[model samples]
Target: MDPFKQMGDWKKNMDQFFGDNFWDEFEGIIKPNIPQINLYQTEHELFCVLNIPGLHDLEKIDIYADMATLELRGVIDLEFGGGQVIKEEILQGAFERQISLPFPVRSDKITATYRNGLVYIRLHRLISETSNKRRVNVRLLEDE
Candidate 1:
C-alpha cells in the first residue's frame, strides 16, 4: 500500500465533493488581495501611486509619514445583490500597506491627494547634497 496512492485517492474525492468554485467562494469570503502600489523617486522627492478604485469617502483614508516610512490605511466597501453568487473576484474590507522610503524625508512636509480612483503621495527630501565637509590643514613653525 503506497502512501502517495492513498493521498491521491483522498484528493480526488475531496475535489469532487467541493468542486472548483468552492475555493473561489471561500477566498471571496475569507481574505482579499492587497491594493497595488507604484513607487518612484526623484532628485528632491519621493512618490507613491496606488490603485484604489471604488473608494468614495476621503475621510476613511489615513496617511502617516515618518523619516523612513509611509503607511496608508483605509477600507473599501463592496455591496453585492442578495442572490446565488455565480462569480466574485473583487475584494472589500480594511487594507493597510507600509512602504519604506528610499531616503530620509520631511514627515511634516508630506502631502497626499486622491483623484481618478488613485491616491498620490509626495514626500519631500530632508537635505540636498549641495555642501560637503572640507578637511582643514594645520601648519607648524619654529617659535620666534
Candidate 2:
C-alpha cells in the first residue's frame, strides 16, 4: 500500500465533509458573537469606532475609559415582530467587554460621539512616550 495515496484519499474525504464554509463556522464557534470595532491612533489621540446597528436606547449603553483600558457594556435588540427566525446573523443581547488601548490616554479628556448607527470614542493621549523623552546622566563608580 502506498502511503502517499492513502494520505491523498484522506485529504479528499475531509475536504468534502467540511465544505466551503467550514472555516467560517469554526471562527464563529471560537469567537462567538462580539461587536466589531476599528481602532486608530494618532499623535494626539486614539480613536475607536464600534459597529452597533439596530441598537436602540442609547442610555442602555455604558462606556468607561481609563488611561490603559476602555470598558463597554451594552445591549442590542432588534424587533422581528412575531415570526420564527429562519436566519439570524446580527449579534443581539447584552455584551460586556474591555478593550485595551495601545497608548496611555487621559481618561478625563476623552470624548465620544454617536452618529449614523456608529459610536466613535476619542481618547486623548496622555504624554505619549514618544513625546516625553529625557536623558539621564550616567555616573562612573570609583575603583576601590
Candidate 3:
C-alpha cells in the first residue's frame, strides 16, 4: 500500500466529515462571547453590567430594551496600529447579544451609562395588572 495514497484518503475523509468550511465553524465555537454581562434584580428594578473595553465611540453602540428582553449591538475596535500579532486573545468585533429579563421591564424607563470600560444599564420593572390580584365588583341581575 502506498503511503501517499493513504494520506490523501485520510485528508478526503476529514474534509468530508467536517465540510469545506470547517475552520470557520470551528472558529465560531472557539471564539469567546463578546461583552460578558452580569445581571442583577431587585423588587422593582433590574441592573445589567457589561464588560466592554476599547469603546471609543459611543455612537457605535445601540441598546434596546422591551418588556422582557434587552439587546446590545456594538463594535469594539482595538486596532491601535498595524503590526504582526504575536498572540491574539482579546476579542474585537461587532457583536449583538440579547438577554432575557427575569421579569417584565419598562422599555421607556431604561437608562444606560458607560464608565471604566464597563456599561451599566438600569431597567425599571413593569408592574402588569395581570400579575396583581384585583377585586371585581359583583352586580345582581334584575328578573322580569
Candidate 4:
C-alpha cells in the first residue's frame, strides 16, 4: 500500500542476496590511498626528483633531513582562472613527500637549487676520514 515500504523491502532483499559485506569491501578498494614518490640511490648519495611546476617562491619549499629520513613539503597551485579546464591530469595542491636517504648527510651542508621545472638537491655524504698528522720527509733542494 506504501511506495516507501516497498523500496525499503527491495533494498533489504538485494543486500541479503549479495551479502552484507559486499558494499563494505567494495568501497575500500574503490577508493584507496596512494603515496607519491620518485627516488634513486647511487654509491655516493641518494637522488630524489619531484615533479613540481608553478611553484614561485623559495619559502614555499620546506626540506628537512635526519639521519635516515628526508621530508619535503610544498604546494602546487592549480589556480588558472578565466579558462575552463577541459581536461586535467596533473596534481595541483599541497603535497608532502618523505623519502629515505641511503646514507647520512650533514643537514647544514645540504644545498638545493631550482631550475627549469625540477628541484635539484645535493646532499653531501658524511665525512668519515679527515687529514691528520702524517709526516713525510722531503729531500733538500737540488738544482738541475
Q: In TM-score terms, which candidate is top?
A: 3
Encode model 3's per-residue lDDT on 40-144: one tens digit a residue.
999999999998898878888999997798989998888677887545567788898788898989877988999988999999988766766678999999997
Ranking by TM-score: 3, 2, 1, 4
Candidate 2 lDDT, 18-79, residue by residue in tens: 87566555554644646678999988888899887776678878889877898999887776
Give the whole-model CA lDDT for all candidates, comma-separated. Answer: 0.77, 0.78, 0.84, 0.69
lDDT of 1 by residue, 33-139 (tens): 45667889999899988777778888988888877888888986655568974444565568886778888898778888899878998889988567778888988
* Candidate 3 weakest lDDT stretch, 10 residues: 23-32
**lDDT tens string, model 4, 15-134?**
889977765655425322112346676676766666777778879888888876888888877468777755545657676666778788777777777776577777777666777778
Residue 7, model 1: Cα distance from true site in angstroms: 17
Q: Show the colliding residue pairs in model 2.
A: none
Instruction: Please give the distance, in angstroms, between residue 49's alpha carbon in candidate 4 and its true position after superposition.
Output: 1.7
**What is the number of backbone collisions in each predicted candidate, taken in the order shown?**
0, 0, 0, 0
Winning model by lDDT: 3
TM-scores for every candidate against the unseen true structure: 0.61, 0.65, 0.69, 0.58
Error of 1 at 93 (Å): 1.4
